[model samples]
Target: MIRHCVFIRFRPEVGEAEKAMIFTEIAALKERLPGFLAAHVGANVSPETGMDKGYAEGFIVDFADAKARDTYLDDADHRRTGAKIVAAAEGGVQGVLVYDLEIPD
Candidate 1:
């Protein structure tokens, strides 16, 4: 299994509606792709201050394996959605952090 974790620092002007649309686009991919297990999206709720480095929002996507994860990466819809996220980010792609974790089953 693989966990795709993405953290973002959205531009100040990016509103809730746009954020919701981005997340909605991401959520819809599960219906079309195999082994795209689940997507968890939300804001940073940690009590600690400054730890997030201004990345207040993020999402975690679970995939059955590396193949499934790669499939999602090559999807056109995901490319578009990722473009949107980059656009909404504070410093374009630099405002986002991605970390992938592989889990043994």
Candidate 2:
């Protein structure tokens, strides 16, 4: 199994309403695409005592393996959702970080 995580930082100028819309679109991807074991998207809620770089939203996706992950990346539904995210991204901070790891248990 693989756990694919993405960290997204929205543009500072984005508003709450736009953020909600982005979140909704992201949440809807699993239903529209195949090869997804699980999917979730949310805003960062971590308390900033000292080490917060101000990342805004994030997504988590689980797949059977690298093949599934690659397929998901090119799927029509995913492409559509990703396009929406790119269009809505506000500032220079709107970035994505992805990590894939095998399940350890």
Candidate 3:
């Protein structure tokens, strides 16, 4: 299995409406894309004690293999959703991240 994780830190000027639209678009990907074992989206619940650049929301997507993952990267729905989400980022920093790995089980 491969895990694709994303972290998003919104620009301070971003309002609730934009955030909601972004989240809704991202959540729709699970049903639109194939090879998705699981997809979860949520805001950071971590207590902001001493963290720098406190990110807002994050998501985890599990795929069966690298091929499936690559397909998702090329998927039309995923691309459209990504474009909307990317537009909401601050300075194009976006706080994006990803990890790919196999799981033995």
Best by lDDT: 1
On residues 2-103, what C-alpha lDDT tens digit does candidate 2 reach at each position? 899877666667677876776676667667555668877787777875343555677788887778888888877677767766665554325656678889
Question: In every candidate, how many clashes are there?
Answer: 0, 0, 0
Give the range of the ten consecutive residues with the poorest summed lDDT in model 2: 88-97
lDDT of 1 by residue, 1-105 (tens): 999999999999999999999998998999999999999999999999999999999899999999999999999999999999999999999999999999999
Candidate 3: clashing pairs of residues = none
> Local distance difference test, per candidate?
0.97, 0.71, 0.72
- List candidate 3 stretches off by more than 4 Å: none
RMSD (Cα, Å) of model 1: 0.5
TM-score of 2: 0.74
Q: Identify the candidate with maximal TM-score.
A: 1
Higher TM-score: candidate 2 or 3?
A: 3
On the 0 to 100 scale, the lDDT of residue 13 in model 2 is: 71
> What does candidate 3 score in Cα RMSD to the true structure?
2.3
Higher-TM-score candidate of 1 and 2: 1
